[model samples]
Target: MSLSLFDEPKLDSHCHVLDPARFPYAPDVAYRPAGQEQGTLAQYLQVMDAYGIRQSLLVGPNSGYGLDNRCLLDALQQHPDRFRGIAVVRNDTPREELQRLREAGVVGVAFNATLLGTEFYANTDPLLRHLADLDMFVQVQVEHDQLVALRPLLERNGARILIDHCGRPAPGGGLDQPGFQALLALARTGRTAVKLSGYQKFSTQPPPHADAQVFVRALLDAFTLDACFWASDWPFLKAPHRLDMGPLIRQVEQLLPDPADRARLWWETPRRWLGF
Candidate 1:
């Protein structure tokens, strides 16, 4: 379809929703947002509608709720057409449980290296096998530097590897950072896909996050258009300030001047990578 930002039916490859009442937040969660009226599914959908985002992938918010995926799964099941989910499960989680998740519209499993540790990533044989059996990707949220150390292991395993938040390079480090360089090399292999998202997560500057382009451009230059996905990281929970969706959407369009590139970023790549 030939379209611009206002008309294109897009897919937000990453976002979150939390309902503390239905699914209690884990006490051991690393951090908690102060407000209860944070991003809920209904609020996120409103943003999606405003942006013409036809579909979204609800990433399991492990930070606030540990491994509990009920909140994410419920949204997936309740709104199958508009959303899919990535669940957070321990390496030892039962196969039957995974099978159930698959049936419930969970397209992948997420690993938070920032919290789960290198050991969790190191022991991937079983997890990879299970994910392969389910035809799902392994989504990793890791420090940019870890991309170098994690590359060989992720590549050796043969399952699809999705890197979160533009490989999360040091703010302004761009291609010079060793980890980002490793990420670029990984992209060339075609087994890896990086999310064009979380601008707020890694940016040191204020709103609009224009400086993040140094990394964004490097990703588009290194990876095939189909290997890069776009996301809102909606609700922007950890950000220093709340963000509006319009500017980010415009930023993506500006970064990808050609409609073909925007198509891949907004829909094609995420569709292929997430089984949408």
Candidate 2:
């Protein structure tokens, strides 16, 4: 079936849209996009329309606008129907400011540990507790190994956790690897969700690599459609090759061949997790 038919309820659970003119990237920021002007809310909406995406969650870009969510928040206000936001904040940020961000349609808090380093939120128990109190989800961008290391702390917090990029498991490691095992264990607790995006970022091989497929299928099987979400990871940051969001969405359709599974991955699950 064509993705157009899924128009009414489709959602991209993770994406980054920024107006570089307003929030330009820092010179030293790692993984900076080739040209800052490639993606914007307007461009993102066009892609969404083409692929029948009704709504999307705008995740804070780690490279630019570090802890300054105004750019994303503004986009959310301007296109409330088509977007929601997840923000990255300093562990020491005032509670009042965080509360204000929540009022601004910020549904979740993100820790970009892969780029910022794991110690960035090391003493973040209080922040995690605050999110739990607000009933907000916690988004983590750590590789599989890091995930395995942090599994205990994440499970103990009891806050809903969203893992980025298929756990970013090594290409040869397979799903039974220690990191993936930890992710599967977290899924069993019914408090975690994973994004089936950025396969390019995880694999050394090019598109349609069988190793990448192995990891994707493992996640789909381990978490079930209800606990999974899909994204374009649009603009494909720092990727060696350019990726079209449209084809990625189509790839997801192929991966989850069951109509019911597609419905859950593309529609039902996002609505529940992103509250759209």
Candidate 3:
């Protein structure tokens, strides 16, 4: 049987598109690419079409692009029908600039603390309040341990949170660890969601790491399908080893085997959360 592109409605809840030629990595950054490279919207669209994805949430890449969301914003404009974006901005980014981004279809502001450090947004209530006023969700990429430190502030502001990569908890730490526990507690409030992606980054084992599965299953059980999202975490940033996106998708398929559950993770949930 031929595989049809529209086998299901798919919304890739996370990924990045960068144009290296236009925006090269800063030399001062801790990690630099081994080689000059570029990945574009056209390249990602082909992957999406092949994988039956109708839409995607394009996040700004941290390693190379820093706070410049131009490449990501440009992609969203080019394929407004198929892409929505989340951007990374400094805490002091102007309100008018943010409004312009909102007009360009950015639904959330990403705090890539995992790569840039949690202190980047520390004590920046003015910025947080601005985002809240704009009604934009805050997508955080902090390590699981960092969640505990952030909980009170997040709760106080009633910020809608999207925790990236299953909170990036230590694989050996287990669910009882403060970070995972904090995440579970946050989920209960109905104000937070977690992305079941980038498990490989936290595990030493191979793809579909059993250690990672423990966390993935726990998140699936904690968050309603509406509060959960999944992604390939394509190009698998800073992995100790390489990973193929195909197997990653299959792993998500395995985790969500029921058709309705699959539909929620693959489509509905992301549409509701990301507003794409």
Candidate 4:
């Protein structure tokens, strides 16, 4: 408990680099992250430096770039050692492209059933299986009971699963909520992990995020400290209100008061997962 986490070397498991000025948003994309939602690499690095974050796992945001991962790839290529990425690829993406992305420092691909809906990804089994074959993670973001239908697809072909934002459970949904339960059941797969980050995304309360504490505890019990990692979801795209990285970091302290648990959650696990 004496640890000063502010200086701890940690890996941000979920974040994005949106440099629209240099990278440009996809014209056909449905949404563009203007204003505070957009974060250039320079700004993010400043935040990272402030927090002593040694590295980050950047996810391609579906908002600004859609299926275009150029922005994500550029950041990875520019700082290969400091960043690894999860790209957003079409379900029909070719194996060669996946390989190319892998070589460029993409360890995985993201599926946003939370935004695009479950039916949009109904026939993604082949892609999912291929990603599994490639040893790349299938990072998923789903809410409510959306995970129930996709659980089987994740299980198929022994895919490496990484659930985002603590499954973004419905407020007051309780620990037994089917989607959250399904997320917990995924722990037995061994190939699965969860990011114990982004309470602001799902929590009904402000900072302390009291309602999410029980779920975080359950995840620690089920997925254990190793498979459950930390993320800031920095720049906090599409956030409902104002957010800041410094406060979220302190919130982790409140959630995992044990310094040992904080050490593992913030540093050891993500470093191991990303092979840093």
Count of steric clashes across candidates, in order = 0, 0, 0, 0
Q: For every model shown, what is its TM-score relative to the native structure?
A: 0.92, 0.92, 0.92, 0.96
In candidate 4, how many Å is residue 227 off?
A: 0.5
Off by over 4 Å in 2: 1-9, 26-28
Per-residue lDDT of model 1, residues 57-176, tens digit only: 889987687788988988987899888888999887766888889899988888887666666677767787777677777898877587777777777767777888998888867678
Give the lDDT of residue 122 in candidate 3.
Answer: 78
lDDT of 4 by residue, 13-96 (tens): 999999899988999888899988889999999999999788999999999999899899889988999999999998999889
lDDT of each residue in 1-276, candidate 2, tens digit only: 553444535788888886777667656555455574248778888888878788888999876667667779888899877787899888876667778888888888898777776766678887777777777878988875778767777777777899988888876777778887888788888878999887876787887545688888888888988898988787666777757765676686678667677788888998888777
lDDT of each: 0.81, 0.78, 0.78, 0.88
Greater-TM-score candidate between 3 and 4: 4
Where does candidate 4 have its weakest 10-residue lDDT segment? 1-10
Clashing pairs in 1: none
Runs in model 4 with CA error above 4 Å?
1-3
Candidate 3 ranges beyond 4 A from true positions: 1-6, 26-28, 34-38
RMSD of each: 2.1, 2.1, 2.2, 1.5
In terms of TM-score, the best-performing candidate is: 4
Model 1 — TM-score against the truth? 0.92
Worst 10 residues of 3 by lDDT: 29-38
